[model samples]
Target chain A: MNTKTRDTLGKVGVFALASVPLLDGIWRVTSGTRLGGNPIETLEHLSGQWALYLLAITLALTPLRTLFGWRWQLKLRRMLGLFAAFYALVHVVCYVWLDLGFAWDEIGTELIGRPTITIGAVAALGLLVLALTSPRAAVRRLGKRWQPLHRSVYLIAVMAVVHVAWKGKDGGEDALVYALVLIALLLPRFAVLAKKRSSPQA
Target chain B: MMRKAISSNEITPESVFLKRRQVLQAAMALGAGSLVGCSVDSAEADTPSAATTRALTSTGSTDFAGGENWTPEKLVTSYNNFYELGLDKGDPAKNADWLKTDGWTVEVGGACAKPGTFAVEDLVNFNALEERVYRLRCVEAWSMVVPWLGVPLGDMLKRFEPTSNAKYVRFDTVLDPDNLKGQRSSILQWPYTEGLRIDEAMHPLSFMAVGLYGKTLPAQNGAPLRLVMPWKYGYKSIKSIVKIEFVEEQPDTSWNLSAPHEYGFYSNVNPSVSHPRWSQARERRIDGNVLSAKIDTQMFNGYADEVASLYTGMDLSKSF
Candidate 1:
């Protein structure tokens, strides 16, 4: 693609990402939601939406970049994953700081006690792994194993759905939509895996 | 992409000003409604300690009491949080300005001697405002001490002169989805309907609240009219009313009919019968700077003395 066009897309990503905190801060202010109830629950809901959004965006990047054949889209994967992690970090902080209130005792009680929370914690950890290793150097170091480590994203998305389903009392269309999006994203990977296994390597 | 930061200064005093404004608005409108049923309100609020006040007047009047709990902020912020009109408990102060309160009719029908409609102005312009500190308990397990202004329910019910067969009184709200946009949600039925046993309706504590915090009931909190029963859970108090009916049989209430197991016709707060999903033992008060809370709830929400007789022989657990 042209350098000017690439430069424009880069500028757009920077502009969009920069405004996210402000956009979100405005929501909490105007929505006038009195923050009560489980902080973990609130953060989970807030971050879960963002995580799904990022996963959707990450999956979209390939389809978008391939269909448009744009190199500018390549830079977006890290930014999108980072956004996903930003939300995930909020989710974890809410769980750790607000919900558990930084008490190892309370954290252990919920993590070890509740199945939904345990699965969710693991998914958050998986996302953390991907976020930490998202750099090109990490990919280069992993070599052949990079694809397998990156594949943990699909697992993270699935666990996220289970997490939401278990916490079903909170009203929304999120869990249902996230599951459908995950299915659509994962179907192609499964089909490719099957094709690779079936083809005779000459 | 719009965003606004939550205003600082800890306690925004605007909410308190709104509550005082609400009562004044109702007091202005009270002069228009029927005057005969509201005299009792003065005895409760104005006379302080008259043992015979209960016997002095059958109709309720504008009463006031000041406890440590009576802060201007709590008075306004603790209002019934029905969001059909707006959010932020104080949204009524801003949005209720557009409500068409005058020249409105409150139709009474179904098993009544006079099945006709009366103008809301007649009741407000004529009736005296009585302020009663009624505790409002939401189905979601939060409580508020509300100083409601209105007349006794019996006085209002007697106006229509119900037929001998009338054993229940049903209230209907303005249900036009276009006008009441929150009607879109399939939560509880919109144009909310709530009912009371004929005897319960006649109870002195059961009043039709027109004003709160010594002012007119804001449009958001069921402007022009609403129900107040210190005994029942808050949902039973339907707002923005348009119709009233006296029925021979028990009428189906919105929440009760929607999910009978969770709600009941005799939805008197019984701490023993737990809501299937959550415990009703404790409630959080609406006064702001609210961080640590969880007050023990009483059976019939402390209204058993006034209302327990109605459910003398009934099983509250099954009914609830």
Candidate 2:
């Protein structure tokens, strides 16, 4: 396939995968099968989980490309990151609008008082910064600084995992699964970094 | 006037009724019913097992009818938080069959005049069961209204004639790991324990729930026996009880032990005191219809008039 056709297919694939959750969420609401008993909670959990999944996937893209020489993976990173941001936005909005009824005063207190929410707010802010700068123009504008700016995603991923771990009422089993996935995705980068530091040319 | 208003059902019972209004408000506020109440099947009736589903006397009136939003028996039975059966909300309904409640005996002792192992059936049969509709608000910010058939906890406790040394009443759930699946995981200190102050334990609202929905208790809903503290959060209502003890010192509770910062012993429904992880200011009614906006949580979960005096002069926010 030509470069343009491959790019088009790639964009289509990203949209398809990302929209699946949104559509399924919508269908669940309309069809009454997936919302469970707590609809807002169901939506909040679904969107938040999807956000974490997409964020992890986006973080994995770099290591996957370096390990397997999958250059096409580079093209998909921005889309996945933006989708993660979108879901994160939905998750936050649900908490603010649905759960809190836009109680700004209480929300302000919660943002500072509750560690779980504070961590969530910071991670969300990081995702927002990354998402806003994801466009090609912003990347060009930020130039060399863009790499470090986007690198904050690893920190954001950790914050998200911590938020889940601390907030889990029953046990941290589900949160631990995400933590394991994040560790697995990050291990390859440490190996590569170690190789660079040990080079004789240095 | 407030009591009369509540009796008149103006205040609305539990979160579900509030949720229905919230859904309506959301439909209007968001300009769409499409977003909330997404599942029609949520209202589908779960057929009771032929063996367990028997017709019983509906002896009690809906005295606590806060609104017309009584939670269905199926949802109440199926969606439970009994960790013994499992952590998942639906696990109890599926796995509780393994719990053999038949021929169960409750060991009652400590600080009381009468102290001995009593047959569960004898205790349940001793009391004249009355149906009382009470709102159950879970600490996870969910609420349900259940018409429970049971005797007053005070009536049963009074029989033992707790001595002045008795400062607290402690209850214990079934401990066998072979039957209760979650017991093996140590998610909580197994053989779950909960306690209440002597005053709180004997309050008129404190009930020893034997059954729900005009029938025998489903194994999932703390079948055979359970403590129902309507004013407090649901976890305080220990289920599948095997032991009841009167103690001088404050008894160690399972949830409070599990996460002292998060779950306090005085887990009264206080919206102001947010849980460490989530806000208790509002709750999503599990029985609410689609589009139900989250309802503001009430102080003492709308039973303030009845139980608020019990905490007089005590700092709830700190004790919480």
Candidate 3:
């Protein structure tokens, strides 16, 4: 397939894949399937998991292109990042509306008092900023500042992993897996940075 | 027996019950389908010990009454925190079929006069099975009202003849890593252990639950035998008990050993004292309502009237 056709198909594939969890959630609610006794908790978990997964996928794209000479994949980053932000939005909405039942006082208390919730909120805010600045017009307007701002995704990803680690009851095997993936993604960047610092003349 | 008035809200809606019934039927069909390839003898041998149903009698005690709506039976059975089966709430129900409850026995040892292994049947038949509705509050800030059928744990403990040295009672869950898959992971100390003070164990409120909702206990709910101390957080009520040890010193508990700062030995449900990770002042009741706001959690899960004396002088905050 040509570049335009491949990109179009890829974007559509990404959109469809990102939507599977949301659609599956709706289907489970409508079909009376096992959302396992606590449906709100289930939905909250599903949305949060997908949000983290999509964020990880978004981060992996740059590493994939750098490692494997793939230019076309770069165009899909914005879309994936936006999808990640969307899922994060859903996750927050589930917590506030469904889980907490719009109890703003309790929500405020959790956002400020609870470490996991506070970390999650900050990471989500970072994703929101990234999503807002993702547009071509915003990108053009920001110029050099955009690159540095977007790099905060790395920090947000770390905070998100911490949020997950702190919230889990079982020893954080799930968080460890995410942390490992993040480490792998960062290693190549660190290696290049280390090499540049060592050979300044080059 | 005088029947306690059950509020209308306490009853599960027919629609929800029917839907759950269908889901359970589907799950049972799938379970049977998987067993199709196994030899008849093997399948027969694999039959759950609690498969046979037994009648239960209600003691008609209103001491621990809360008049809260009963969490739907499906939710009670499916939503469990039994780590031996799995970590996820739903995992216990899904993985529990592997648990072999047949010929289960509890070895009574340590500070007790009669240290002997007794079959689960003997314990269940020790006293007439009585039904008690209890509010089960988890450390995770979730609550459920369940109708548990069993005898008062104190009566059964007395039969074992505890000596003066028996200051604490420690209960141990079954340790079959092959069947209880969660045991394979080091998420927690294996063969989950929990303990209570000698007086706490002898408290009339502490019960040995053999069944729930007027049926034999499902493996996920800790079939054969489990403790149901209504006043304490749910974890204190250990499940699938295989051993009961009366110790002179305070016994080490699984959660307390895992996180001393978080889970204390007492673990009585106190709204004032919060878990280090989250607030324990409020809890969401899993009553089939997805949109319901969390209700204020009660001290001792609303059994403060019956159990406040157990911690008369000790500061709950410090002990907790």
Better of 1 and 3 by lDDT: 3
Task: State each candidate's clash count.
Answer: 40, 9, 0
Task: Give per-residue CA lDDT, model 2, range B111-141, as digits (tens).
Answer: 9888888886667653367888888899998
Best by DockQ: 2
lDDT (0-100) at residue B194 of candidate 2? 97
Cα lDDT of candidate 2 equals 0.80
Candidate 3 lDDT by residue in tens digits, A54-161: 998888888777788777878889998998999999999998898888888888988888899999999999999999999999999999999999999999999999
Local lDDT at B141 for model 1 = 68
Per-candidate TM vs. native? 0.65, 0.85, 0.89
Candidates 1 and 3, the one with greater DockQ: 3
Candidate 3's DockQ is 0.39
User: Ranking under DockQ, best-scoring first?
Assistant: 2, 3, 1
* lDDT tens readout by residue for model 1, A1-202: 8988877778686648644643653443354332222222334455677776776777766655445576767666777776777677777875566433466764675677667778888988888888888888998999999988987787788887878766533222446667787787777667767778889772
Give per-residue lDDT, candidate 2, residue B11: 51
Worst 10 residues of 1 chain B by lDDT: B40-49
Q: Kindly indicate the candidate among 2 and 3 with the higher DockQ.
A: 2
- Which ranges of candidate 1 are over 4 A from the true structure? A1-63, A66-202, B1-68, B71-83, B86-99, B121-127, B184-188, B257-262, B270-278
